[model samples]
Target: MTVVNKLTRLLNITYPIIQGGMGNISDPNLAAAISNAGGLGTIGVGDLPINEAVYKVTEMLKQTSNPCCVNIPIAVHPNVSHIVQQMINLKVPVVSLSAGNPAPFISLLQQHKIIVICVIATVRQAKKAEKAGADIIVCEGYEAAGINAKNESTTMTLIPQVVQQVNIPVVAAGGIADGKGLAAALALGASGVQMGTRFIATKEAPYHKIYKQAIIQATDESTVIVGRRYNRIRRLIRSEYASKLLEIENKNDDPAIFFKQTTENYHKIGAFDGDIKNGFINGGQIAGLIEDCPSVYDLLETMTADAKQILKQSLEKLE
Candidate 1:
């Protein structure tokens, strides 16, 4: 039997997989590549302005005929309305919202009849998102990379709780790299799976080579959380900068100083300059599971094939 749902049918993808949108990582190239590979690809326009976002959407659409998604994290940035209207005007297939309740933007996108998916870290947040007219709810665990909510929850516990509370389809994320994780998420009542760290190890991702290498050589404890005072806690790879940040926090030092120092150099040291030592590596615990960097197509093929095999075997054992 085929495991299909509104996501698969609406996105017209063979696998019920959605590429987790990572800021500065999920660009037009990577997004199109994943969609072309038979999964829902997502471009993170959470930080971009409306004009740039429109250009990006047009560029990405030119790359693939398949459906793709655009992510907007409304809590951090200004011009949320402009971005939402731009996405609607472009007719983007899907919009995945993170870091805030999507209720306010629901009506804006609904007018265009756009499909909306909201990312949540807790069951309460999931219920809120579903009530806000989210077509799909992605339950992200504490193990995820990048910016996460202060009230972080593990996917193993959060997924079942969210599935029980919401009638909409749930997609599980955080520390998912291979088929075993995918199968486990499905067994927990998620209709699909979303992964960011796994895709960062792909060749199409625009992140620096050093960042990808760091992901490959990382361990379960390689990640640390920082930036709590700003109401945004980010899980980043443990580097010299991250270590310093922790030291300051441990001593109960001023968060403003840490935020200033990090904001001043985090992007330059990590993204633009690719300074792996002083730079902050935004990644998840799943980085430890990845060894080699492959094309997005190859990665999806392996994941889907292995997941099918494992799931089929489990059913056979029951028989």
Candidate 2:
């Protein structure tokens, strides 16, 4: 009946369910709600200015005394060093680093007693993060939303390999949105699960109503892969905008025009403004599994309860 494990204990949360960082469209209220609900809520800073990112993190901290994490895309942020220093200054209890090498900052953050969680899409990256002294590993598969690895590995196949490759606790991400998914991840040796698309469908996620609805109505084939030709490798819900982006990729080898349309500003237009025609919104393949836009607390609670039940049932059936 216990969901308590290395990840929950390490992060000092009630469950190991985590919300993936949403980059530029990051919201503090959503992050706070998750933290207040006894899970490690993460505020994604994406490519935000250092001041803005600090303001968001500070606001989330004010809303909840519970330990929360900040996600920084290390390689892309304009203020990488400054943001890293700000996270240290703000004393953000946990920090998740992605899209870049975490080696340089892992020890520095740990020196301040901040727990480091590295998000990687490949086995090699997971091992490297562990060696770089990451306390946890968030192994995201190609089924995840937004930018992905060029190889497009799935969570089902990736998690166990990463769990075996890294010594630290591994949190499975991509294509996980329910208790069944949670049960599956644990069975695969993952210490926990991180969900992005599922979070967007929740009441607290701050995405446009239309954006959330899109997740609720999504089907397995609703998600399409773009940028494969140019090595951008992102997953998003199929849309006129997505099709146009794909068309560009197919027609031209250079991704300059495609990259322009896929920037965070464009993402903001879809996620916040509900402009689906011109802006692209990120969604994972797991969108097919979501049916309702529950509160974050309800989502986590049900996930843990159901996971426990399913795990017990699965063991009995197997035996």
Q: Which candidate tops TM-score?
A: 2
Query: Model 1 clash pairs?
Result: none
Give the residue spans of candidate 1 off by over 4 A. Answer: 1-3, 251-253
- What C-alpha lDDT values do all the predictions have? 0.82, 0.91
Where does model 2 exceed 4 Å of error?
Answer: none
Alpha-carbon RMSD, each predicted model: 2.1, 1.1
Instruction: Please write out the lDDT profile of model 2 over residues 293-318, one tens digit for every residue.
Output: 99999999999999999999988998
For all predicted structures, in order, the TM-scores are 0.93, 0.98
lDDT of 2 at 130: 89
Error of 2 at 115 (Å): 0.2
> Residue by residue across 280-306, what tens digits does model 1's lDDT show?
778887888889999988887787778
Note the clash tally of each candidate. 0, 0
Model 1, residue 267: C-alpha shift (Å):
3.5
- Alpha-carbon shift of residue 187 in model 2 (angstroms): 0.5
